[model samples]
Every structure is written in structure tokens, then in C-alpha cells.
Target: MNGFLQEKPIKNFLQSMDEFFSNPFPNSAFPLTVKETTTANLIIAELPGINREQIQINVYDHHLTISVNYQELITEENTQQNFFRSSQTYKRNSRTVALPYPIDEKKVKASYQNGLLTVTVPKQKGKKIMIEES
Candidate 1:
């Protein structure tokens, strides 16, 4: 009975840890905000601890995508004992949003400053179709 009781607690603890790590970002790593104007749409993303060089933005048709890729390398050495250790970590995050109207790809603009990324997408003009009487 005692053995079974101890095993149950261990199993429960392991299961809880698994659940926690499975969904590391329960909400999201970064918060995102989108605004729409009369002629353009604005997208703002908060990316802390990320560099401008690590961010990528793409605009296609009515879809906008933001991707972030970061890499870190750590090295430790002990000259006296001739020991060395090195480690590298890589993380990637991405988000895609759909615009209400077709975007003018040529007029899209993006900027990154102080860990904040902003993208401006202009709306494409609609073509008027002529109707003919049969």
C-alpha cells in the first residue's frame, strides 16, 4: 500500500510538469495589436529581448507574416585546466494576420525600434467593373 501511494504522487507530479511544458506559451510570448485606418492598416508587435536583425516581415496579397529567429552561443574555458565548454540555443516565433482588403505590396513599410515592430500596409484600390445591357 505504501509503495503504491508513493508511486501515485510521483506520477502525478510528472504529469503536471509535462502539461506545463507542453504549452509553454499559454497565451503568447509577445502581445500583438492591429489597427485599421481609412486607407491603411497598422500592425504592432512587442518583442522583448529580440534584435532587429532577427526579425523578418512579409506581406503578400492580404496576408502579413512576422517571423523572429534568435540564436545565442555561450563558451566557457579554464586555461589552467585546459577545459572548455560551449552551448548554443535557438528560438523561433512567428505570427500571421489577414487584412480586410487586398494590400498594396509596394507600399508596405516596416520598422523596428526598442524591441517594438510596426508594419504599415496600404490598401489596394478596387477596380470598377462596367455592366453591359444585353
Candidate 2:
């Protein structure tokens, strides 16, 4: 009975860890806010510890996408034993949002400051069509 109890707790712990790692954005590492105005749409994202070159923004039709790619490195060195160890890790994440109105690709603008990414997409002008009945 004791062995059974011990095994059950260990199994549950492992399962919980597996679920956590499998879920994307488990800790809300990437959060985004969108605001729409009469003339344009604005997107604000919080990306701490990331550089401007590591982020990519795309606007197509009514969709907006934000992608990030970065690398992390860890190094350990010991002079007495002459031992050195290094490890590199690469991480990539992306999020996409659908806007209510079509965007003007030529006028899209983005800026990053103080770990905040702001994107502005202007609304496309609509053309009116006239129908004539004969």
C-alpha cells in the first residue's frame, strides 16, 4: 500500500510537468493589447529582454502577426581544473491577430521602446462602385 501511494504521487508530478511544458504561452510570457480608432488600428505588446532586431511584424489583409527569435547562451569555466562548458538555446514564438478592417500595407509603422512594441496600421480607404441599370 505504501509503495502504491509513493508511485501515484510521482506519476502525478511527472504528468503535471509534462502538461506545463506542452502548453504554449503557459506563463503568459507574451501579452498583447489591441486598440482600434477611426483612422487606424494599434497593437501593443510586452516583450522584455528582447532586441528590436529579434522581432518581426507582418500585416496582410486584415491580419497582423508578430514573431520573435532569440538565442540564449550559458558558459561555465574553471581555471584550476581547466574545464569549460557552454550551452546555447534558441527560442521562437509568434502571435497573430485579426483586425476588423483591412489595413494599408504601405502606411504600416512599428516601433520598440523600453521593451514595448507598438504597431500602427492605417485603415484602407474603400472605393465606391456605381451601378447603372439599362
Candidate 3:
């Protein structure tokens, strides 16, 4: 069956091409390794120079997003300067990951340690999903 009268999304072929050209150099996302546990999916992100206190995690609209914000101090020692130059820089990065299925938001657990952020999203106790013939 042809989708002649059905409403389409806002994205089209031209829009996709425009978006790709607009963002030439994409930002490097957090290096993450996702694994399935007994009850949940575990995602570990390797983010250096991120403070534990600055890590933010939230669950919204059945989606989970984690943002990390921190500052790194860089001191120039050999720069031909009479005084040392120290600069503090701030960077913020976020990642949005969807669960395999609907999950209990209250059971989400996240922790950060040694520049690594670990997240545990538990699987929901769900009813048997069945498809019926129309």
C-alpha cells in the first residue's frame, strides 16, 4: 500500500541533507559501552575531567538523559611568561539513550567515579505483550 494521504514527519530528504551540511564537524560524544545485565542495561561513559558533583541525570518522557558539566584547570609552565598562566575551562556534554522497553524510572541508578559514569536502568515487570489479528 502506498502512503499517499498519510501525514508525514517534518523531516524530508532535502531537510536531512541541509542538516548534514550545517553540522560539518560533529562533536565527539561520550565513549560509552552498553551491556545488558540481569535486570537492566548498564551504560558506562568514559568522560575525563568531569567532577562527580557536576553530573546530572534525569528521566523524562520515558527517555533518559545524562549531562555532565565540569571545569578543567590548565597551567602553562614553559610559556615564556614571568608568571604562571592558569585557565579554567568549562565543558558540558549530554547523552540521550532509550531503553529496550518501558522501565521503572524510580529504579534508575547512576554513579560517577574516577572519570567514569555508570548508569543502571532496570527492566520493568511487564505483562505479556501479544499481537492480535485485526
For candidate 2, which ten residues in a row score worst on lDDT?
A: 20-29
* Model 3: ten consecutive residues of lowest lDDT: 1-10
All models, RMSD in angstroms: 5.1, 5.0, 14.6
Which residue pairs in candidate 3 collide? none
**Per-residue alpha-carbon lDDT of model 1 for 64-122, expressed as tens digits?**
88988878899999999999999999987789989867777788899888888999887
TM-score of 2: 0.69
Name the candidate, 1 or 2, with the larger lDDT value.
2
For residues 19-126, what per-residue lDDT tens digits would candidate 3 score against the true structure? Answer: 889875556567778889787899898877767788788887567888877678999776566577789998777888887576577888888888888989987776
Question: Could you tell me the TM-score of candidate 1?
Answer: 0.71
Q: Flag clash pairs in model 2.
A: none
Q: What TM-scores do the predictions have?
A: 0.71, 0.69, 0.58
Give the C-alpha miss distance for residue 98 in model 3, angstroms: 0.8
Off by over 4 Å in 3: 1-27, 71-90, 129-134
Candidate with best TM-score: 1
Error of 1 at 125 (Å): 1.4
